[model samples]
Target: MTEMNYRTALVTGASSGLGRGLALWFGKKGVKVYAAARRRPQLEALAREARASGANIEPVELDVSEAETTLERIRELDDACGGLDLVVANAGVGGMTDGRNFPWEHAKKVIDVNVTGAVATLSAVLPRMVERNRGHLVGVSSLASCRGLPQNAAYSASKAFLNTFLESLRVDLHGTQVRVTCIKPGFVKTEMTANIQHMMPFLLEAEPAVEFMARAIVRGEDEYGFPWPMDRAVGLAKFVPNVLFDAVASKVVL
Candidate 1:
């Protein structure tokens, strides 16, 4: 296994879910971790947890939905750290919407957080990485991005956009020392997935999921999706006839 021993790292959405797990994982490896999230209390709690384990983690209050401030804050953090060896744009939101009712507000929020927020976080750090000629950027997408589902179209679309955005970054940065990785996870047992009503095939807890993701990041994989079962299912779904897919997907409650 490749040893991911970055000196300094920043993880957005580090207050909870996979983000929290990733921050803790990095911290345990002796990486100075800046844990950014909208919730200050949660961030503090996470910091305490890390410190208890002899991990160097600091809490950073950040709300990625605020584009201008998010960009400024991330850039400031990057500079303050001398330089960030790794940045994970892991902040995102999920929503369930019905096409018939068309909840524009909910859909808009999902896009704002998942797509725009991620772009802001990445764009802020990218320039410095390019200038330094070394850094790793990772974006957390979803397996749902492989296909649009009935009630969760907005969330799926946002992840799809992120996947494409990350792909573009990887391709454009070719031959550069900077690396870009996109991690697409299936249903993980996080707050986001807690309310999912339908059966979640190959469900994994947050810690294991984050571990899998960390390995991929350290290996500098351009794009990765997990677990293997979900990845295969989604891959096959991509080739299914639209009519048949629609017929089956429409029945999904999530």
Candidate 2:
């Protein structure tokens, strides 16, 4: 679809990281952005930048885990915009965990943000998109979903859930005009990975990464994974024998 096709878009997690990058790109492209995030100041900053770009932007207060209220607020924003043509369920958390440090709350919070939050965000907008029969839905999965990493039990699992969810939705919505796309990025330099202690090969900066994703989104791809090398490596991991993979993965310090 053309850039002009999307008059209104709602981007969750727009306060920082990939979400912010996507929001900025969307605004730059002249889409009215419903920027959803938990931080008022950051969202305000986004609104200011959008204004400078002569873009229409509304910084909607959102904590994606707050499923009920988040949907309500998003619905209100959609109503104000008259309609929403694109919805990016990008809010997620990568709560670190270790064998000894694993806690129910920590893992739960990660799942709540990465999985349930996407569900809630999609749940809120999908019906409207289906009803209108013209729109795009984006879920940001990760290359981590291709395999289970030792250090990222919750984080990897959550992303795998995202990949699965979006693909399932794509099949379910096959004949509809509504489009569903799942983007899996290997490593994009963002606040989330700023302090990551392991090697992140082929990590793209946020802007370029979002730009690539935007192109895919515009084309309405079913699923796209990028930074080719990492995508290939991760995709290949799915076919590796479990025992051999576990033996090698055990050596991964991070």
Candidate 3:
């Protein structure tokens, strides 16, 4: 993988899954990483592993769902570090929602972590990065955003919201040294997706998935969705007639 120009990074949800992988990847590249997650023990373990490998990683105990705390903690880190060159809002939650009798609490949790949390993460550092005229901001969206999936109303909608938000952010920051990237990934094996019993198309292991995302961020792509086959499949789904799409999507077991 090509080395990232960023010297310091902050990755939310860094205790496990793609977040953990990305943090390790960045640390291996000699970037000072602030790995944030609500799980203190996991974060500490990750830090130990990274450090043993000669990587500079600091564990940050953070719960992104609490907006105020998230902002305060991230701000403190940014201040302490002088500034963070890259900030990835990788924190997210996923679950199936029942539409028959809407699961408001479940939906709320999904939106809270996946949508609001991501926005809060980016909002915390955006101004400082703009003032310094350099930094990269990235969000982990999903291919589910291409079209709503069965029993995944909240999760899909949350990612859809993120996709548009990142797109607008990218356009608004155009011509500036600050860059925004939205990465829509297909199913990647992780704790979040471990309960999924359906056959996931083009499923990628977390390590390779993180590698793909890291490359995209380093290249500063405005938006990237993969793996290619799954991305193309979802892109084509966008062109399907609504009624037909709904019929097929509604039957999906995931």
Candidate 4:
């Protein structure tokens, strides 16, 4: 878990939002970054900006939900890079619906991308890391994982799965050079939340959020929950009675 220079980092969902933020931030630190997203144009623009800043950035078109395609791309990147030092399984989606009324298809898609996709990415990269015995894996969870939210039931549950999965991996990797960290962040101003009609408490801009996440990865922290206020809020939400939480959360509008 000692500080090591990461030569190459792979970031999924890099077309925009937190993934884009992380790619740009890591590039600034002189790491070679493989930015992946479904849109080639946006990914190319990101690559252009990062390259202008002197970071080795390669944009790859990817849809993490598409297991086969994503796995193939990872293999190609691993072969191209010689090795991958970091993998950020950051692709995710959010849908608003009460648990009972939520569309089954949408719920399934959330689990597919947030849960299965995350596992698939790790599976594709971990063997190589295990062989080399050196690498960092970061899964982007959310403060919503701290407690169940009424409207975003599937989204919250998906993140909760990630939180637990990463924590277990952290323990499993004990004594090995490989590191795992789960990041839980409050609302951030990104494409993901931009359309939401809810008030976001202690929301942070994407840049600072990315910087914090990257620092946590560099420090090899086991878990990171951002914006002190949001951390405290989530902490309290965990202990608060469900009745009170439901009532309070029902009124929120971003």
- Number of colliding residue pairs in model 3: 0
Give the RMSD in angstroms, all C-alphas superposed, for model 1: 1.2
Residue-by-residue lDDT tens digits, candidate 4, 1-254? 43248888899989999999999888888788899888999999998888788877889888889898778889889999999999999999997757556688888899989998887787687888988999999999999898878777789899999998888888888998999989898889999998887678888999888889888888988899989888887888799988887888777542
**How do the candidates rank by lDDT, highest first?**
3, 1, 2, 4
Candidate 2 to truth, TM: 0.97
lDDT tens readout by residue for model 1, 2-21:
44558999999999999999
User: How high is each candidate's TM-score?
Assistant: 0.97, 0.97, 0.97, 0.93
* Best candidate, lDDT: 3
lDDT of 2 by residue, 1-254 (tens): 87789999999999998889888888888898889989999999989988988887889888999888878887887788888999999998885776656878889899888988899898787888889998898999899888889878999999999988888989989899999999998888988898998898998998889899999999988999999898898878999999999999888888
**Comparing 1 and 4 on TM-score, the stronger one:** 1
lDDT of each: 0.91, 0.88, 0.92, 0.86
Report the C-alpha lDDT of model 3 over 147-232, residue by residue, as the tens digit.
Answer: 77888889999999999999898889999999889999999999999998989889999989999998898888889998999999
lDDT at 185 for candidate 2? Answer: 88
